[model samples]
Target chain A: AQSVTQLDSQVPVFEEAPVELRCNYSSSVSVYLFWYVQYPNQGLQLLLKYLSGSTLVESINGFEAEFNKSQTSFHLRKPSVHISDTAEYFCAVTISGGYNKLIFGAGTRLAVHP
Target chain B: GAGVSQSPSNKVTEKGKDVELRCDPISGHTALYWYRQSLGQGLEFLIYFQGNSAPDKSGLPSDRFSAERTGGSVSTLTIQRTQQEDSAVYLCASSLLAANPLTNEQFFGPGTRLTVL
Candidate 1:
């Protein structure tokens, strides 16, 4: 079975500060990694995904994540965050060619302070 | 285009009662999925439906929880004899295809928050 672990339950950062949300997964076979962001009282939206090719995937919102095959990690990073960036971020994984059911982590609450 | 939508944004039911949560996936989406988000379980997949194929019920927690997708567009997740443990937000997502990751990006609904009293 595949599983995902989000190392931080909560991440606090000041506005314009860098932030990194750690995520690790345990899967025997190849997998697809994704980051979903949920703003206050809103549904989750796809932030970015690492399917193939580039190990470093980026979202249009200036957030990026590097898929480290050796470490089995896909950590999300942002050079500088804004107050609007405060949200709950989730890390998810699914088998490369298997069913589309996603295995999600516990989620990390990103509290960007002004 | 409109995204996935879920009905009864919030549901309050008593224990031992039954409840039904509805999900309306994006039109033309071939794949739909149900997931539960709770304090204890976080987020867990409950069921999956793809086109006309057999629905996957492997992720269901127990027999009390059942779901069905009709016409490949709308889905209903029925929880019979609900318990306090069943109190959580039920989320629904849909994608164009279930096979290819390049094009299969799941779009989620606002979710139905269920509270068992």
Candidate 2:
């Protein structure tokens, strides 16, 4: 079984500021990591994912996340955030073998202030 | 036709009533999934269906929650005798064949917000 933990429940940042959302997971075997974002009253959208190869993966919208095996962490980062970036973010993990199911974190609410 | 579509964007039901939520996955997506999101909480897996494989219902909170996918396309999640705790947004998602080694991106639906009173 795999589980994901997001340390921050709420993250507030000013426009154009850098922000990082921390996520950690525990699993016996290798797992896949993913980040999804949800805007107000909207469904979640895939931001980025770390399946294999490079430990660092990036999204087209200036969001990136690094997968750390040693630390068991996959933290999401953005160099500069815009007011429109305000939304709820989730970190999820799925085991490679066995049943394919995603274990999600509690989620982090990012409020970008203008 | 563009993305995963869900019916009844919002459902309001009374306690002890039964409610059903529907989902239409994207064409060609063989893997369908159901999840629930409580207020201020993360998504809880309910069931997963992949190409004639046995559906995985491990994450279902209780027997009150049940789901079924038909013809490898649409899926329905039902909550019998719904309780206050069942008041949450029911979401459905789908992806290509899980066995395929390519990037697995599960496209999500708008989700049905069920409010129990």
True contacts kept of each: 0.84, 0.60
For model 2, state the Cα shift of residue A49 in Å: 0.4
Candidate 2 lDDT, tens digit per residue, A21-63?
Answer: 9999999998989999999988999999888999999999999
lDDT of 1 by residue, B1-117 (tens): 999999999999999999999999999999999999999999999988997554578889999998888897898999999999999999999999998888789999999999999
* Cα lDDT listed for each candidate: 0.94, 0.89
Q: For residues B1-117, could you state the per-residue lDDT of candidate 2 as single tens digits? A: 689999999999999999989999999899988888997666998888886454688878899988888888888888999998888888998988765436467899999999999
lDDT tens per residue, model 1, A31-60: 999999999999999999999998999999
Q: List clashing residue pairs in candidate 2.
A: none
Model 2 local distance difference test score: 0.89
Provide TM-scores for the models. Answer: 0.98, 0.96
TM-score between candidate 1 and the true structure: 0.98
